[model samples]
Target chain A: MYRLFILAKCDLGYAEEVGEKVSELEDVSEVYSVTGEYDLLIKVNFDDLQSISDFVQDRLHRVPHLKETQTMMSFRVYGEDIGDFVN
Target chain B: MYRLFILAKCDLGYAEEVGEKVSELEDVSEVYSVTGEYDLLIKVNFDDLQSISDFVQDRLHRVPHLKETQTMMSFRVYGEDIGDFVN
Candidate 1:
């Protein structure tokens, strides 16, 4: 699978609601309200690069109050949770 | 806790080693070899912003062949994993 790390900038006071709305969209596995230039970070899982493009064009753009988005697509996932460190 | 989403650019062929070394460090939760302008994406957790600064200055900067770093600090985490969708 491919993972697209999206840094989203939403309209004022819409961060929380945007997170809730994005999380329910297809392949969006995680969402966080974050500091810095972006207001939200999203993890989107899909089969290929085109799917990611489709998601951005089809679903993500439709999320209300979402003003801007920057996606950092992953080439490979190196580590996961605490389980990785377990012996 | 505060979460810093770091985007790293590493020297050629050093991405895998960088990921391994970073995952062993303190407060780092996940590492991914990613596409786009950056080579790696890291999730770092700490008590405050100061700790995030320290990690960058004290530890992350020391990783071999790691050329650049960009941190996107998180204000709050909204959703996680499949369990969130389960009833």
Candidate 2:
């Protein structure tokens, strides 16, 4: 699985609702309402790069009120808790 | 809590060792070995932005063989999975 983190900006007061909508989307593993330059953070898993492109560009970006998205493709994970992984 | 995702590029062939060292750091939530421009992905939780800055610059960046890092800060969590939360 590919781990992708998307930083998103949303319309004022729409973060919570946007998060709800985003979570329901296919391949969306996690989404968060956050503080910073971006208002929401999305985590997605896909089978390949093409799958990510289709999901983000063709589908995710179509969601209303999310103003912008910056995608960061992960190369590897270092500190994932072994205990957490076990559970 | 503040959520941060860090994309890291490392020297060739050092990913597994780097992952082990990173997992031992304080406030580090998770890390994954991934594929892309970067070699590892790091997730960290800090009390505030200042803590993030300190940890990334003063502590994390010091890990050997990991060449560079880019950070993304998150304000809130949207779809972190109720079941995951419940667990």
Candidate 2: regions farther than 4 A off: A79-87, B7-20, B33-40, B46-58, B65-75, B83-87
Instruction: Kindly list the per-residue Cα lDDT of model 2 for residues A1-87, writing each as its tens digit.
Output: 566788788888888888889988988877866555787767787678778888888889999888888787765555444443311
User: Cα deviation in Å at residue B2, candidate 2?
Assistant: 4.8
lDDT of 1 by residue, B1-87 (tens): 677889999998999989888988988878888778888988877777777788999999999999999888777656554332210
Q: Report, for candidate 2, the interface RMSD.
A: 4.2
Model-by-model DockQ, in order? 0.53, 0.47
- Predicted structure 2: clash tally: 22
TM-score of 2: 0.67
lDDT of 1 by residue, A1-87 (tens): 667889899999988899989988877777877767888888877777777788999999999999998888776656544432210
Q: Which stretches of candidate 1 lie above 4 Å from their native place?
A: A48-50, A79-87, B47-50, B80-87
What is the DockQ of the complex in model 2? 0.47
Name the best candidate (by lDDT).
Answer: 1
